[model samples]
Every structure is written in C-alpha cells, then in structure tokens.
Target: MMTLRRKLTFLVALAAAIPVVIMIGLTLKAQENLVLQAKGELNLLMRTNLAHIARDIYALCDTVNDVVAKDLDMDLAAARRAMAKCGAPNLGVESADWDAVYPLTRQARRVPLAKFMLGDAWLGQSRDPAEHVPVVDEIGREADCVCSVFQLMNEKGDMIRVATTVLDETGRRAIGEVMPAVEEDGSPNEAIAAVLRGETFRGLATVITNRMFSVYAPTQDANGKIIGMLCVGKRPETIASIRKAISGIRIGKDGYVAVLGGKGRFRGSYLIAPKAEDEGRNLWDRTAKRPDGSEHHFIRSMVTNSVAGGGRAIHFEHYPWPKPGVTGAEIPEKTGACIYFAPWDWVICATLYEEDYHAAADKIESTMTSLAVTLSLAGLV
Candidate 1:
C-alpha cells in the first residue's frame, strides 16, 4: 500500500497536470481561430478604406481637369493684358471676354486659379505679387497637358521655374513667354520619350522634390493621337489624414488595424505597441532580410488601383516579421509585404499579431480550467 503522503502527492499532481495541459491546448486552438477571423475582418476593412480613398481621388482629379480646361478656353490674352494694366477695366474686359468664350466662363472666372495651382500658394513660384502669372503657362507644353505634380521654384532673380508642360497648342508657345521656366531635373524629355515615340505610358511615378504621388492616365484626342495625359496627385495632407483616421479605429481591447500599401509597405495603422520605425517606410523591395531575421505573415487583398480606378491583386513575399523561433533577432527589418491584386489590378494588405488579439480568450480559458480542477478535487474527496 502507498504511504498517505505519496498518495496525496500523486492525486494533487494528476489534478494540476490534467487541467493545465487541457487549458494550454484549448487556449492555443482558440488563439488560432481568433487570429484567422481577425485577418478576415481586417481585409474587409482595408477593401472598404481603399474604395473610399479611390473615389475621393478620382473626384478631385476630375475637378482639377475641368477647372484647367475651362481656364485654358478663357481669353487668356485679355487676362494677361489686364495684369499688365493696373486697373479693373482691363480686368472687366478680360472677364467679359472670358464670359463670351464659354458659357461656364463666368463661373470659372469666379473660381480662383489659386485653388488649382500646384505651388504652396496660388501665386505659383513668383514672390512678387505684380509678377503673378497663370499656372497654365507651365502646363501647355506637353503633347498632353498631363504632367507630374512638381514644385515651382525660382531659378534666378525671382524667376520661377515651371517644371511640367500643358496640352494647348497656342498656349504652349504662350507658356514660354509667360513662364520661361524649365524643368528642375531636365529629365522631362527622357521621362516622356516613350510617349513621344507613340507608346503608351502606364504606371505610378513620383515627383521627386515634393515627394508627391500621382497616377498618369493616358488618353487620346479625335485624331487617334495621344494628345494628353490626366495626372492626379494626392494632396500633401491626404496620407496623413488617412493615417489619423485608421489610428482612431478600435478593434477588440487588444485588437487593432493597419493600412498596408499594395506593395506591402507600411502606410498607416492603429496597432498597439507598433514599431516606431515601421511608420512611413516602404516595404516592397526589402523583404528578404529583416533586422530580426524572422519570418512575417502578411495578408494580400485586392482593393483599388489609384490610376485606373479599378481592382487588382498580386502576392508579395519575404515579409519582415520575425518567425516564431529565430535566433539573433534584432529590430524588425524592412521587408516586402504581400499584396493582393484583383481583376481591376488594385492591391491591399494588412499585418497583425496573433497573441495580442486573443488575450481575452486566453484569460477566459484559464479561468474555466481552474474552476474545472476545483470541482474535480472536491468530487475526489
């Protein structure tokens, strides 16, 4: 027969081990399920957010195009002549001529060119108020008026440089006299060389100085010639505002949200305990070697393409997160996140932590196991 102490010890050990083992298994299973669900929800959120962003961008682009077209059709000669004169009569005649040119001229004239001009202020690059010129002068030189968003800077003696060209024939010549500015980088010729060679230019390009992101839409005129491109750029504050909005969303107590770019770059987030360095960094090209040398899991979902206003999905690999077990873990290295491309070719994605999201479930599982053990002990007694 076993000694009393040994018997008691055996019973207590069995009671504790069984519940603890069961609890751990249950907790792991619950965590996995919760994580999967959370991922689905995150993808849905991303899709919705992307749709809204695309809609707003397209609307803004349309508005800018209409505004430019109307401004170009007006009596630009009279406007310039009026600016030369210091009185409102020239201004009035100019305004009347503009009204006669287009039915929408009256409304267009009332609309400040300052609103559509690309510089810090509607003033373009000119510091002298008297030297104020229409931004159209810079826009009309291209085969198409579609040019990337650029900074208008003073080249010399307060002469502002117009970096891009516009779509008008006569207006193009006028741009030379009125603006007399050249591209800062002198690469416009190279950038549009393919288009000049009768090739279609499709894709995203950035204006280096302002770090402005724009989508170039190719379009042709009645002559089957690619006359112009429609260029749309997100405002400086757009991404910042998106980041702010995502940060405000609350998922569970520990759950959070993030907006990853189609290339799996960090765009914005509402993560708890998020890495400080990950913000505002592009993750598309840097996925193979993260600082931590850990594997990361990223979800790719097709959302919206800014340029075409369509949907597309594509997969990206070598995400930056550390694997469950990896040695020499340093700060998470930048890696390419996965992207989902849909039929429309828009991409979307998100990242999440499994443990953080299922904390509540883990606690609940622990409590239940403890209660079950207590009841088992009482019955044994």
Candidate 2:
C-alpha cells in the first residue's frame, strides 16, 4: 500500500529527526547548568566585596582608635591635675559645690550651668555651652570623623556632652545634650548604657547627628574609677568612591548588593540601603508573602544566619520576591547569599531575581519545543 519513493522519504526524515532530538536534549542540560554557574559567580562576587570593605574599614578604624587612646591618656593626666586642687588625684566626675572648682558660668544650652574643666586650662567649652574644646576639635579635623567627650553628670548615670565636633542642625556643637540619661521612649538607652557598664563599644552608633561606625571607651582616673567617655567615629559610606562601588554592584537584572548592621546599636539598621526610603530603618522583621500565602521573614533569616556565621563563613538562602517594578505579580523563588563583616558588625548580601536565571533556561526550552514542531512538519511533508 506504500510507494517505494514515499517509504524512502520517511526513512530520510526519521534519520534527521533522531539527531535533532538528541542535540536539543543536550542543550537543555546545558541551559540548566548555566543558571547554576551564574548563581555561583554572584556568590563569589558578594564575598569578594565583603573582604574589600572589611580591609579598608579596619585600617580606618585602627587609626581612629589609636588617636583616641593617646588622647585619653592626655586627658587623664590633665584631669588628675585638676583633681589635685580638690585634695585628691581621683575626684568624682561631678561637683556638688560648683564654686569650689573655679566655676565659670555657662550659656547657650537650654539652661546655663557652671563649666566643667580639666586642670583649669582645657575648658571643654567656651563660655557659651555650644563650643568644642581643643582636643575634640583637633581630632575631628585630623581624622575627618566625629569626636566627642561626655562627662558623667550625676549619680543617675547621665552623660552630658562636655565637648564635641558633633553639631546640631544650626551647625553648633551639641554641647550639654544628654546621650544615655534617657530615651524618647522613656527607656534607658541601650548603647551608651552598655558603655557605662564598663564594656567597650565598637560598632555602628549615632551620637547627636552623625550616624557612624564608632568606638566608645571609658576615661578612668588613676584609681580606675570611670569618670567620662571618649569616642572616635567615621561614616562608612562618606567616602564617595567606596559608596559608588557598593551602590553600583548588580547581581542580575534588578538584583543588588546591600550592607546592613548586624549587632549592637545598629542591629538590623541599613548602612547602604538600596531604597533611600529604607535608610535609618530596621528591617530585621520585614516579611514577604509566599505563593501559598504563607508569610516569610526572609530578611530576618538571612541576617540571623549570616551573623551566626561569626564573620568566618557564608550563607545561602532562597526567598520569594515580586518582579521589580511590576504590580500584583511576584516571583516565587529568589536566591540570596550573605556574610558577616566583623570589623564593622555589618552584614553584606547579594540577591538574584528568579527571572534573570530562569529566563535563560526558559528560552532554551522554548526553542526546543519550536524545533520539534518544525522538524515534525518537515517529516510529514
């Protein structure tokens, strides 16, 4: 019932079709391999950037810490001289009788008070309360970061600004402003309070106006009683070159790298925020909805696990995200890599959008489908 010519045509078509199917299968496997490879590349990039930042930050912080330490010794010598006037080398931080301490009237604060001095020479402020002393201003000028001194005000554990390069909105030193005496929420401020407990604090901090990576150490007398606090700080992103490098990092079409604070005063705080709106916000508990409508705290998990790595390891996770700039539609699975930067107590993350990788595989699979249709058509003819 079949002609010899027709049967011959069928054999040729089958021969061509077998090779086409095999080639498509091989390409399909390669398409999957591409996605995996891409993911690994991004992960490596994230860590490389992390190491880069850590090196630079440690260098800067080291210089600042050394300067603060030397200044603290200088301050202790001067304060001991002033305390000798009061019949002791280690008098308390505050005086009950202001007249006995060569008292100078203070102004420019909300309420004027007697000036606190070290050795009757290094007055932390001018007659106006809002002025910087020689040492704090010199350190600020040399180090290019905020510098400050906060002396204990009372037995209530209040630290009043004695001198500082930190400014109010009007550009005057925020002298006499209280840091850890209280919080707006009526709770004890955790960061400075911890310093009051004799723990050295070194991480992200906000004193007065500048948010920065800072080190706070207690200034003690010869008797080893805590008298005041000394601080040195630097804004991590204020370096324009470093800021541009970090903000420019792109993981795959719409995916980006970000820096966050991992612990201490800045836990969950955004250091290098992707969205400007997220600046100064804590995102530890931020959540997204999965496809099944289940809630997922992906950020919480990512940061928590990365910090647990203790700056010696890396972590990977898959999470859900909406297609960037699209409404009412979200990708069900996105991949992220995170690591802890111990020097600054920072967490660095790189994330990849689902479509960026999957789109390649999907295109290959679609091509295979189209090829099958075309080959089948040729064989039927």
lDDT of each: 0.34, 0.61
Model 1 worst lDDT run, 10 consecutive residues = 90-99
Give the residue spans of candidate 1 off by over 4 A.
Answer: 1-205, 209-224, 227-234, 248-256, 263-280, 284-348
Q: Which residue ranges in model 2 land beyond 4 Å of their true spot? A: 1-117, 120-134, 138-143, 153-158, 181-201, 235-241, 290-293, 323-333, 367-381
lDDT of 1 by residue, 179-268 (tens): 112223232322243443455333323232122223432223334444333343333343344345544544323323343433211222
RMSD of each: 14.8, 7.5
**TM-score, per-candidate, Cα-based:** 0.37, 0.63
